[model samples]
Target: MTTIERELHIEASPEIVYEVLTSPEHLVKWWPDEAKVSLAPGEPGTIAFLPDYPSVPLTVDEAIPVSRFAFTWAEDLQVTFTLTPSGTGTLVRFVESGHADAAGHAENVRGWDHFLPRLVEYVPTTVAA
Candidate 1:
C-alpha cells in the first residue's frame, strides 16, 4: 500500500488540534469542498463537492481524544492523524495509506500538503479566541 505522510507543527494544544480536526465546521474550513463529520469511531460522515457530484462517505476508525484520530476516507484510503504535545504547541503527524496506484498516492500527498497548512494556520486563531 502506498502511504502519504506529513508532519505539521500547529501552535496550539493537542486538545485544540483534535477539536479542529474532528469538528464538522472546522473540517469544512480546511478540508474537502464541504463536509459533515461526527468524530465518534464507527460513525460515518458525508463529503460533497459540486452540486452535480454525489456525496462521498467517510467513517471514523479510531479516536482517542487528543492523542489520535483516524478514519476511512474516499472509500479505500485510511487517514490517521496523531497529535503529540510539542513544547507548548502540537505536532500533528498526518498519514493516509492504502492508495491503489502511484498517481493516487502522489495526488493525496499533494492533497495533504495543500490542506494541512490550512489547519496549522487556522488552529491557533480559533483556539486562542
Candidate 2:
C-alpha cells in the first residue's frame, strides 16, 4: 500500500477550509503534536505526535493558497492536502504516498481516520450569505 487518499466535505468555504489546514493554530488541534511549524513552502517543521504515534520531521513542499498543500512526511513519504470549492461547502482531498513500507502505510491510514474527522468537526456549519 503505497498510496492512500480520502475525501471530506465540510460546510465551509475553500478559503476557510484552507486556513484551518495551514494555520499552525489549527494544525495543532487535529495534527496531535505541538510543534512550531510554519505554513510556508520550503519551511521545515516537526510533528511530535503522542509517543504511540511517534514523531515525523517534515518540510513544507507545496503551499498554494486556498487550494493545495503538500509536505514531506518522515523519511520516505509525502502527504498532500487538496481543497476545492464544492457548492456552498469545500472538498478536502488528502493523499499519502512514497516508499513507505506496509507498516507505515497502515499506520497512516489509521492516522487519517483519527485526524480528518477532527478536521471536518473543526469546520463550522455554513451560514447563509
Candidate 3:
C-alpha cells in the first residue's frame, strides 16, 4: 500500500479543531460545495464534489472526535485524517491509502492539499463564534 501524508499546523485547540473537521456546516465552508453531515458522535459526513474529477460515491468509514476520520471512495480508495496536538495548536495529517494506481494517489493528494488548508483557515473563525 502506498501512503501520502500531509501535516498542517492550525491555530486552534484539538477539541475546537475536531468540531470543525467533523461538522458539515464547517466542512461546506471549506471542502465540498455543499455538505450533508450529522454532528452526533459516530455519524457520517460527506465532502461532495471532490474537485477536479468526476462524481464518485464515497462512504464515511469513521468519525472519531479530536483524533481520526476516514472515508472510502470508488475502487477501494481510502482517505484518513489523523489529528495530533502540537503545543497550543493541532497537527492535522491526511493519509490516502488503498489507491490502485499512481494517478489516483496524485489526484487525491492534490485535491486534499487544495481543500484541507482551507479547513484550517476556517478553524479560527469557527472557534471564535
Candidate 4:
C-alpha cells in the first residue's frame, strides 16, 4: 500500500478552492489538457489521460463541502482531498493510496506536479471581496 501526499496553498478561501477542485466545470480550467474529470462529488467522477493510462472510473465516496472529499477509483486505489482554511488562504492536501509500483507512483506525482500549478493560478482573486 504505497501512498503519496501533496500540499498546495492557494490564495482563495476553502469554499472556493473546494468548489474548483470538485466541480468538473472548474476542473477543466486547471486540469491538464490530457486530463478529463466528469461529474462531481456525490455523483461520479473519472480521472484519466487516455492512450497513456487506464481510465479509472470512480464514485464519490464522501464529501464534506469545504473540508474533505474521498473517492475510490478501484478497490485499492483511494484518493482523498482535504481543504483547510489558512490565514486568508486555503491549504489543499491530496492523498493517494495503493499505487501498485514505483512507476505508478512516479506517474501520478509527475501528473500532479504538472496540473497543481494550474490550480493555484485558477484560484479566484475575487474570493476576498
Candidate 5:
C-alpha cells in the first residue's frame, strides 16, 4: 500500500494543534467543508467537501490528547497525526496510509498540499483569539 507522509512546524503548542486537528468546528476551517465526528475511538462519522465531492465515511481509530490523533476512512485508508513539542511551538507529523495505487496517492498528496497550509495559517491567529 502507498503511504503519504508530511511534516510541518506550527507556531503553537501541541494542545492547540491537536484541537485544530481533531475538532469538527476547527476542521471545517482548514480541510473539510463539514465534519460530523465524535472524538471517541471507534466512533463513526463523515467529512464532506461539498458541491464537488461526496462525503467520506470515517472512524476514529485513536485520540490521545495533545499528542496523537488517527482515523480510518474510505474503507481502508488510515490517517495519523502525531504532535511533538518544539521550541515555543509544535512539530506535526502527518501520515496517511493504505492507498491502493499511485494515482490515488498522488491525488491525496495534492489535497493535503493545499489543506495543510491552511491549517498552518489558520491556527495561531484563530485559536489564540
Candidate 6:
C-alpha cells in the first residue's frame, strides 16, 4: 500500500486547527467545495469537490479534539491528521494510506499539495477574524 504524508506548520492553535479540520463550514474554505460531515466517530458523510467530481463517501473513524482526526473513504482509504502544539502555532501531520497503486497515491499527493496550502492560508485569517 502507498501512503502520502505531509507536514505543515500553521500559525494557529491546535484547537483552532482542529475546528478547521472537522467543521464543514471551515472545511469548504480549504478542502472540498462542499463538506457534509460529522465530528462523531463512525458517522458517515460525503464531501464533493465540485464541478469536476461527484461526492465521495467517508466515515469518521476518530476525532480526538485538538490532537487527531481521521476518516476512511473510497475503498477504505484512510486519512489522518495529527496536530501538535508548536510555540504559538500548530504542527499538522497529514497521512493518507491504503492506496492500491502508485497512480492513485500520486494523484492524492498532487491533490493535497494543491489544497493543503489553502488551509495554511485560510487558518490565519480565521485567527484575525
lDDT of each: 0.87, 0.80, 0.75, 0.75, 0.92, 0.92
Model 4 off-target regions past 4 Å? 32-43, 50-54, 125-129
Model 5 CA deviation exceeding 4 Å by range: none
Residues 1-129, model 4: lDDT tens digits: 588888988988888988886676676677733334443555655665545645656777777889997877744678888999998798889898889989878887887788788888887643543
**Model 3: runs farther than 4 Å from truth?**
38-46, 50-55
Query: Clash totals for all models, in order?
Result: 0, 0, 0, 0, 0, 0
**What lDDT tens digits, residue by residue, belong to model 2 across residues 1-129?**
489889999999888888777777777777757665677777887777877646677788888999998888676688888999999888999998995488867887888898899889876632332
TM-score of model 5 vs. true structure: 0.96
lDDT score, residue 129, model 6? 87
* Candidate closer to the true structure by TM-score (higher is better), 2 or 3: 2
Model 1: number of backbone collisions: 0
The 10-residue segment with the lowest total lDDT in model 3: 39-48
Residue 91 accuracy (lDDT) in model 2 = 90
Kindly provide the TM-score of model 1 when superposed on the true structure, using C-alpha atoms: 0.92
Evaluated at residue 36, the lDDT of candidate 6 is 88
- Show pairs that collide, candidate 2: none
**What TM-score should be assigned to candidate 3?**
0.79
